[model samples]
Target chain A: MKLNLRVWRQQNTDAEGAMATYEVDGISPDMSFLEMLDTLNEDLILRGEEPVAFDHDCREGICGACSLVINGDAHGPERTTTCQLHMRSFRDGDTIDVEPWRASAFPVVKDLVVDRSAFDRIIQAGGYISAPTGSAPEAHATPVPKPDADSAFEHAECIGCGACVAACPNGSAMLFTSAKVNHLNVLPQGAPERETRVLDMVAAMDDEGFGGCTLTGECATACPKGIPLPSIAAMNREWLRATRKARR
Target chain B: MTLGPSVGLMALATRTERRTEPQPSMTRIFWRSTVGKKTVMALSGLIMLGYLVAHVMGNLKIFFGPGEFNAYGHWLRTMGAPVLHHSWALWIVRVGLLAAVIGHAVSAYQLSRRDIKARPTAYVHKRPRASYATRTMRWGGIILALFIVWHILDLTTGTVHVGGFEEGRPYQNVVDTFSTWYGNVIYIVAMLAVGLHVRHGFWSAAQTLGAGNARRDRALKAMANGLALVLTAGFVSVPVAVMTGVVS
Candidate 1:
């Protein structure tokens, strides 16, 4: 299949960027989207032009490194992350426009690559357990309710893709931060630092210059793993309780 | 009433303000920027939702008897956790609630404007599948704003004009006002709007904070919708029944 591509190109993090158009032919429908891009880059290299720069490690879609906003969506035309999307989703003569996540916090590194380290910083703030790792306790010692365990697993599924930040109008990362907070706060293992976790994560998220969540649900809609928005609500409730407790 | 040119100038001025590039002031960013403001709004809005549930339950005391209703109201007014009527307790509560309401409203306005600007063309997405409530958020918000103002004036300051109506008669005034057919109709419509708004708002708010996952998304949405329906229906039925002579 022949396709017209408008890919974002930039020399470095500080460089001004714009969409550069390219035409590619003979792409396989069975090829994954990233593979198709690989073919395009191969063609570019053959023609002595610079290959389109992008981020992808595990083409299996778990790492969430393959970030692109195809035709205005966070990943592509589909709800899944960019890696899982296939070329078959596009038509033979499709003109796909691809760009990096256009968020200030996640600045464009080169072309499709973005500095998602802000997410790392936010995570560092509160997305971990502070308990000592020396002793191993029995799994059933805590005996958490089945529902709480299930919810924790669901919240823990988030891969920290920055797609939510890109998809949101306000560019809020509340979904990302809240998911982490709720995941830890829900579990008995996470109970000791629950209050501090929410406070630190929330403060860090704001300090990182990411926007707050606006209840738009676009992040969830764009999320590849399908993280629910209710985690945010739970987090908010937890935060309120924590704040009240702290005040007293 | 004859001041037409002044009104025109005022309209033009407001339009220009809307059209002007959003000047990023410190206060503006805190209140209207995508992240912080929306987080504050979602958090406060959730708090208000809690208050609404409790308020609705309190309002249901009218069915128990006038003495019960009035006594309930009196208890709420008189009760203080620390037993200091002359202290700053009441003022602190009022300030806190006021701040929450203001934060929620300002964030909503900022978000509403952003939503308008984010999609220049209406329904740009090929699939237009937003719920009816989601679509009518602006309208519902406006109606709710009006309802809230009228509610404050009617109950708090006694601005709602009805002949021979006395002040501080929240229960009696409610019954009297709702006893009229037109009043019942208006109240029912507003309550329906509230219900719709709450349904979407609750779920969407959760999504904003990032707690929403696919497994619990439907459940949270249903729960929110159910809560909204129950509270709105219960409250609206009071006025509706009285208007229809069924409550007497």
Candidate 2:
């Protein structure tokens, strides 16, 4: 099968980008979307032209490194991660437009890759427990309620892929920050830093120039990890409690 | 391994610099983030929804005749008895409702602006995964705003009332407002918008205020739909009754 791809191309962060058309034929129905891109790059390399650059580390969807907005969605035609999306979803002669995450914080690095270090900075602000890094404590040392542990683990599924940022019309990072905040704050071990975690991380999020959440919910839909929208509300609860506690 | 005197001086300097960094109040910090704004939107929406529920219940009193509806209107003013002046309780409710409206509008406007700022560039091929109600929020809000102004003019202030506008006769004024075709049109259209807004807003408010989860997702959705349907039926019932000569 053959597909027409309009891929965004940029030489560097400082360079202006545009959509470059590529016609790739003989694509297998079983091939992943990224594999299809690899085939395109291989053809470009053989032709002595600059290959299209895109980010991919795990190719298994666990590593959130593979980022692309396919046909206007954060991942591609499917809600799954870019790497996990199979070529069979599209028909022969289909036109697929691929582009980097369009956000002020995540600037285009080369082609499909956008710098996602802003997320790292937010995590650095809090997103952790400050217990000494030594021999790990026994899992059962802290008796966490099953419900809280389950909720925490669910939020912990977030891969920090910036899909929430990319999917949001406002490019808001609330869902990402909320997931990180709730993942720790819901657990017994995270109680000590709960109040400060929401504060510092939220501060970091704003400092990074992300957009505000309007409850449009495109982020949750686009999230590969299926992070629920309630995580953000949980973060809101945390922030309110933290604010009131700080006031006292 | 260490430059003792210089390091000591540097530590002191760092401490001084840290101290000089401004410590923003928790309220300021909370209101600055998208999560905070979402919380405000949710809380305010809940407040308005509560008011609508109560208002619709009061409207149902019209089914009991003019004496009952008039008495109900009078009762609203004397809510606090001799302990508090007449209409004082009503004024308090009014003030609160006004604040909620202002909070909802201001947060929505600000967040919309921020959302746009987050994405300087839009996707070349855009496809949204959000619900229809969520997509129509901005226009729905505007329609509701315009409706409120016309509603107040037609009924509350009677500035644009078609028939004889009688003071203190809440039943007659309501009937008079509905008697006109324009009144019914505006009121019915507004109610439809309200239904859509509540259908989306109620569920969203639950998520924003930390009252939602995967287990309760369906229940929350049901409740939202129920509320929207009930409100629309409840509010629209009066106008329909007037048109059918059941109330008038």
lDDT of 1 at B162: 54
| All candidates: TM-score | 0.63, 0.91
**lDDT tens digits by residue: candidate 1, A1-248:** 99999888889988877778899899998988898899999999999999888888888878878888888788887878788998999998888888888666787789889898988998887788766567887777788999898888988888888888877765768788878888889998898778767766777776666655546677878899888766666776676556545421
* Reference interface contacts recovered per candidate: 0.20, 0.78
List DockQ, one per candidate, in order. 0.11, 0.55
lDDT of 1 by residue, B1-248 (tens): 58789898998875522225543444443443354455676688788888788888988887887788777766666667456574256466667777887878877786666554432322112334346777677688889888878777766666774544665556777777776666677678888988988988887767655465657778888888898898798878788667666655
lDDT: worst 10-residue window of model 2 chain B:
B13-22
Query: What root-mean-square deviation over C-alphas does model 1 reach?
Result: 15.6
Candidate 2 lDDT, tens digit per residue, A109-139? 9999999999999999888886766798888
lDDT of 2 by residue, B79-178 (tens): 9988889999999999999999999999999878877788999999966557888888878998998898888888888999877888789999999888
Candidate 2 collision pairs: A170-B115
Q: Model 1, which residues run further than 4 Å from truth?
A: A11-16, A133-150, A246-248, B1-103, B107-132, B135-196, B202-248
Q: Top model by DockQ, which number?
A: 2
Off-target runs (Cα >4 Å) in candidate 2 are A11-16, A137-149, B1-22
Task: Name the TM-score of candidate 1.
Answer: 0.63
